[model samples]
Target: MSEWTVHGSRTIYTSPWVELDLVDVEPPGHPRYEHHLVKWAPVAATVLLNDRDEVLLMWRHRFATQTWNWEIPSGIVEAGEDLTVAAAREVLEETGYQIDPRRLVPLAYNQPIGGMSNAEHHVFLGRDAVHVTEPVDAHEADRIEWIPLDRIHEMIDRREIVAGVAVTGLLQLLARRCAY
Candidate 1:
């Protein structure tokens, strides 16, 4: 077993989305060290598909990266809530599409290892959805549009949507399709 010691920790920043912390610790057989850690809230996302095989996507401006990117409807999972429930809620809040929990197909989970913290993302595929209203999360996304499934590869190759979660979810969906 590895030895661990936490000397101290401090919050570097805090937002509704995430909190960053700097922690001083000692690792096994190593000198004392400090690492800037991100304490992120759990997030849930959905790959919603319609009868026409179109994927629901949102165009948003990521202020941290200063880039406009295409992403699926997603949000921070509330504490004590089931991941699937969170996914359904996020889709409805972000894209105005309410989907049954049973319709959600588990796709993948992502923990961006390159990042300082472990932010687990639960991704699901929402099959056969019907639009009910317009997006309401003004701060989260600018526009919600349905992109044809067949064109996703071209968009990815062109670097139109570069979010890791979106890419992973799309690839998982593709793999599932190819397996049939």
Candidate 2:
């Protein structure tokens, strides 16, 4: 068995969303190596489907890439809160659509290979969604629309919705439907 020892570690940066730590480690019979690790909060997202089988999506401009993309409502899981509750809250806050918490389903957990952050995304099929208010986080999204399930593949292929969580949630939904 190979053994590894952590030589040292230092904080590179800290932010509300994430913290970066740089560490030096040595593997058995190998030279020292450096690794940059990111610690992030757990995040949750939802796929809100209405009675018509349309999925609610938000059109937002991601400043990191300076491009607009379609995405589902998602947010960080607050301390001492349940992931299902957070998923329901995100859908309501981001899309102004309220859904029954009982309908929230376990979709999938994802970890972006580029980062160490792992976010558990819960997707749900909302069969009775009603628009009751405007989006709470106006700065996060410019517009919101309901897209048919059939067009999701085309949107993904066209480079419209590139968010990892959104893609995984939608694909899980499709897979579940196919299994039925």
What is the clash count for each candidate, in the order shown? 0, 0
- The residue-by-residue lDDT of candidate 2 on 96-153, one tens digit each, is 8887777776777777554443334455445577788987877778889989988998
Model 1 has an lDDT value of 0.83
Among all candidates shown, the one with the greatest lDDT? 1
Q: lDDT (0-100) at residue 138 of candidate 1? A: 58
lDDT agreement with native, every candidate: 0.83, 0.79
lDDT of 1 by residue, 1-180 (tens): 675788999997998778888889888888988888887778888898777878889899887888888998777888788888999988877887889877688898999654478688789988867668875665778888999989888888987788888988887887786542
lDDT of 2 at 174: 75
Which one is best on TM-score?
A: 2
Question: Model 2, which residues run further than 4 Å from truth?
Answer: 1-8, 27-29, 114-126
